[model samples]
Target: MLVSEVPFHYKRPDTIVYRCIETPRNRWKTKPTVADTILVVEVVSPTTVTADTIDKRSEYARYGIQHYWIVRMANDDGPAVSIEMLTLNSEGRYVSNGFRNRTDDYAAATDTLTPFPVLLTWEQLDEGID
Candidate 1:
């Protein structure tokens, strides 16, 4: 949503698309053709986990958003869970790309990925987010 307010130009092999609209209802909108190869992340909650894992999974597949992630946090100490990454397959199903516990580095998920090349970690996320 942060980036949607800005206008930009997207060029494809056959088209030079210009998007200038602002204040759109759904800022996370993605085109079906390119959405299958894009990454999407959503913070998970007790009520939302099921939807994120099942409902949204299907929706993303329908829309063709290839990669999706659900980050969950709980009170248990077994694992300071923070992040989960899902990658879409040719069959339109998402597969677990990675899961990071409290101390694990999140940067690994960004390698070789477009629009997300920076490294992140649970420690960094928890430091300020609580």
Candidate 2:
């Protein structure tokens, strides 16, 4: 699904907070800051690569997004693969705790997941599904 399609909400003790709920001018909603358990994914392009890697990275960290996946699609090569994964640390800063190049299988830290799983690989991504 596209990034815009995901529903964002803030969870309070007694109610759910929604951003940009009653605004005509605020057509596009900004990222959520509720600190709920969620995953945010951004598909990267040449033009948006820098913004995705730098600007949004800061924003997502500011809002305490648990998992941020930057999917980079290569030209004339293969499907998109995650170039970087940032996990929020205890110090309220995002650390590049995980990464995978075009030739490696992406793996998360064992503490991050039970039984620790490797999510994807270059070969699996390059093999385009029909």
Candidate 3:
């Protein structure tokens, strides 16, 4: 139900999965491993641009996460949750599934937002903002 910070463990001896250290702990009290993750959404910041857009994007794809979303919520030209969606393709690489903005509806690639059957609305995510 919660989008917890989970790491992906690989069979390969040396694989690096990114980690986020700062947290409030209400939502991510339990961390999950990468393999256990169904979807990974990263909220980008200036310091995390390289890691989120490049390294994490590559690693998550390689690790075979079915759904990956890079959320640019703050730096956008306007007020909107600009979502860059990626889905794992047959060749084991992540391909773009197009983009969605705040006004747009994101019915999760998994088709359900999980734990609750509903469209992925901006209001759903805004709950934590206040």
Q: Which stretches of candidate 3 lie over 4 Å from their true place?
A: 1-31, 75-80, 103-118
Which candidate ranks first by TM-score, i.e. highest?
3
Colliding residue pairs in candidate 3: 6-32, 7-33, 7-34, 8-34
Candidate 3 on 1-130: residue-level lDDT in tens? 2223355233221122334435545644444455556667777777778888898778777777777777776563323367676778899888877676665555442234432242555655556564
Candidate 1 per-residue lDDT, tens place, 69-112, comes to 76666653222376666777888887877666565544442333
Model 2: per-residue lDDT, tens digit, 15-114? 1223343433254344333433355666677887678788877866776666666767766234655456667788877777666665454342112441
- Can you rank all candidates by TM-score, best first? 3, 1, 2
For all predictions, the C-alpha RMSD in Å is: 9.7, 9.5, 9.3
Question: Positional deviation of 9 in candidate 3, in angstroms?
Answer: 7.0
Highest-scoring model, lDDT: 3
Residue 96 in model 1: lDDT: 74
lDDT of model 3, residue 27: 49
In angstroms, how far off is 57's CA in candidate 2? 0.6
Q: Where in model 2 is the C-alpha error above 4 Å?
A: 1-33, 105-118, 123-130
